[model samples]
Target: RKPGFTLGAGILPFTHADYIGEVRESGLSYLSAIKNATQYRQISDDITLNAYAAYIFGLIDLAFPDGRPVGFWFNQIKQALYLIDSGLDPQIIANVIEVQMLKEYGVEPNWRGCVIDGRADLPLDFSESYGGLLCQNHWDKDPHRLHASPRAIFYLRRFSTLDLNKVERINVKLDTKAELRRILDVIYTDMVGVTPKAKRFLDQMHQWQDRLPDDSE
Candidate 1:
């Protein structure tokens, strides 16, 4: 999902009564709890996503199962501020924010780690940011090409602890007929410890293939 600001909304199955009872039972200060509940509702109204919306609605119902509807609303708002400040991604943030806004009645402005290595951390978020950054620098748009670039691989290898030997093994396993022969030749000459076993295996396989009946038709 993309990153941006918006109101909140939710889609869950819960009655106002269920929400109210939980509030009184929790023993929180009436004014503070009310504010939290309100914010939760507002944030729930603004954000968009099916799964989270349902969860927030369920949370609200559990929190205030018997209180007045207005009280439930206020409490949600207060909860939203806390959820938003907790570093949730945009889609989740939106659903959670609305639920909190409706329950609490206040808004909190705290969101971070939305970007990684100058790329948007979320799926679509990267499309815009990456595109803009690449265009500005006159770079290619294709991700495969970008990732294959030497500079890109260098940066990735610098940040990651990958196994080069394993990568070589995988490449050898998938090599074309000509490529496989070239790689096998190198292994026979340069590789140590496993060369004898590899050569024996290849020899046996080639002999087995030679014994198969020809199907020229």
Candidate 2:
């Protein structure tokens, strides 16, 4: 999500029902609640992954307000909604969205090779401060560089270029998902400098989900 946009939930009263009707016809409306003099209504479509839909909508609201033109992001946003609607893992979908957000800001981390020496064969570490990967030879530059494993790096590269519509479901390991989350968190902090409330809530939700007992057990 973009910096400087703070998101929260509340009701906005629209005294005029006609205005709400126009807003819905613009093809830019998200799920919202409506209340009129006569009745109350919740305006929402049938969503498969309800929690994921909420989280994704929250993230969008955190960045873009009403009537904001998401020019370049239109397609990506649609793709994310489609993927999540089809029941893709929310964590990976979140990762993909975050990566694309970084690209939109032109600050996405470099994963191609070592930022300094361009040595693809060497072990690489992701550096949020430098905004790229750093090889062991240059690890001295940032003492806090992520001791990134090859698998983490591989997925980062993959997500960086992922086309949500073209891909099928990818079941990422828990450990890999954690690593990716950590890496993205650091980069988002360093670059965007704001932790969205929606993202924080999403993280908390994941933690609670992790504590649940598996049915197979």
Candidate 3:
């Protein structure tokens, strides 16, 4: 198997579908083998989460040739899977990558003390057009500002520098969970200007999973 010796084998581009099949068979979650979990009502959701993990890795695999650092992406993706495998909210992982994507393309938010040179103690506000967090002073000047609660800020800070291992050990409140989703949805929409298909699928699956089993008499 010398280099440039025999055939074009392994030289062609590998499709993501191929990668998904490989991972599915590799026994990570046995997604293709198992139909449902024994006790969970949300097995479909779990399967979708596993697929989402693969999707994230696929994105990172393809992103390297476009000037992304391999090591950085590797770490980030490993952390993403860690978050997923540990049963944490995939939104955290999604926002982590989304934030980095924004920053890489010069769209990262300015969540640092109200967009710099502003009062540090002022209430935190978000301005997508301004590229970060704003204080009451700055937010009031802009008509497009959105409020960010301290709870939302707490989780956003975690996404900024999340220790994937450490985050797996923590729990979040229901109210905090709802607020985080609100803050993240706005941030992502403003930053990217479109809802990703994966996000839509996850949202739909969430709603579908919440329906009670029909008990028609």
Give lDDT tens digits, candidate 3, residues 1-217.
Answer: 5675432332222211111122343456321222221221232247676556645654454444544457766666666665566576665566567656555434566655677556568677667767677776666666876666776775775577655556645567757766776776776666656454556666766678558575663
How does each model score on lDDT?
0.31, 0.68, 0.58
Q: State residue 58's C-alpha deviation in candidate 2, in Å.
A: 4.3
lDDT of 1 by residue, 139-201 (tens): 335352122233322222221333222221111121133332332233223321122232344
Per-model TM against the reference? 0.18, 0.70, 0.64
lDDT of 2 by residue, 111-151 (tens): 68888888878778888778888887899999988888888
Model 2 ranges with Cα > 4 A deviation: 1-48, 58-68, 213-217
Model 2 scores a C-alpha lDDT of 0.68
Q: Give candidate 3 misplaced runs (Cα > 4 Å).
A: 1-45, 58-69, 194-196, 209-217
Model 2, position 67, has a per-residue lDDT of 76
Q: Which numbered prediction scores highest in lDDT against the true structure?
A: 2
Candidate with the larger TM-score of 1 and 2: 2
CA shift at 167, candidate 3, in angstroms? 3.2
Candidate 2 — which pairs collide? none
